[model samples]
Target: MWGVFSNFIACEIGFWIVIILGLFTRYVLKKNKLGLFFLALTPVIDLILLIITGVDLYRGATATTAHAIAAVYIGVSIVFGKSMIKWADERFRYYVTKEGPKPIKLYGIEYSKHYLKRWGKHVFSYLIGAGILAGVILLINDSSRTEALLRVLQIWTLALGIDLVISVSYFNWPRKKDD
Candidate 1:
């Protein structure tokens, strides 16, 4: 059983690596503007292969828990993707509009904190999204299943695409205005 157990451990490590890299890239360096782009693109890349080539990303051949974990990850990231967008907008002051930075408010309370200061939302969204994505994978495998999975995946793609465009624009904002 060492084979199975070792594989599971490896799977968890890989998942965290991607997440840790994202956290480091976005949190430590504060390059979330760029990290958001990557964050949005990774799944799109994997999704395309699943739809066209019928090959799984995390699963080379056997559908493992690793694949399921990755799916939850995709869903969560996209769902709370707006938070990352807001974080980049306020923290980096990228794509600054004529309006000034508004305080982050939750439930009518002025939180007055960084968007990422609320890691709970990000983690929650990531987990939920991953579950939905795992469901999509099961649907995709069903020979009798329709194209519904593709449609759901497309919705996320479109949403992420919009977020990506907005994020890229922020990067172009002048430093003078950011100060």
Candidate 2:
């Protein structure tokens, strides 16, 4: 369990490290090809996490919260990773290299729409993660061993519901633009 948690943390840290390095190489050093190579490594990081979690489960370890979260993390990464990289790229280009326009700060209807789109992504991520959790539970076929994963699924479902409410509320009350 701890191993999963530790590796999850390491994977997260590594993801950011690779992103920063990619941005720096791309914008600061103007090494576009090398930077793209670094950026492309993000999926490999997700694969590593998935493999570790799968291996742990195969070793007869009881499913844990960490294992469940690793699934969620991978799912979220798959859904959001490209956008995150693009987000970083925009900021890096504008702030570091002065090679692009300032990233737009969405407000009003735009902000609400952006929020809703993000919420939709969250919904997709939850579904993917829940599916993985469910698959694991069925594969193990042991209630006692898979109880933690079921709990995670229940809690994540609740969280996603709450997020939906908040996301909808944004459309009702759009954000004000800065003066």
Using Cα atoms with residue i matched to residue i, what is each candidate's TM-score against the true structure? 0.33, 0.96
Candidate 2 lDDT, 48-101, residue by residue in tens: 999999999999999999999999998899999999999999998898889999
Question: What are the per-residue Cα lDDT tens digits for candidate 1 across 1-179?
Answer: 24333444454454445544554577557787765654555445335323422344323334444434345445564565455445644543323332346644342112222223344454465446545664656655752342434444555556555654544444354123222
Question: Candidate 2: how many backbone clashes?
Answer: 0
Which 10 residues in a row give candidate 1 its minimum summed lDDT? 107-116
Tell how far residue 12 is off in model 2, in angstroms: 0.6
Scored by TM-score, the top model is: 2
The C-alpha local distance difference test score for the whole of candidate 2 amounts to 0.93
| RMSD of candidates 1 onward, in order | 13.4, 1.1
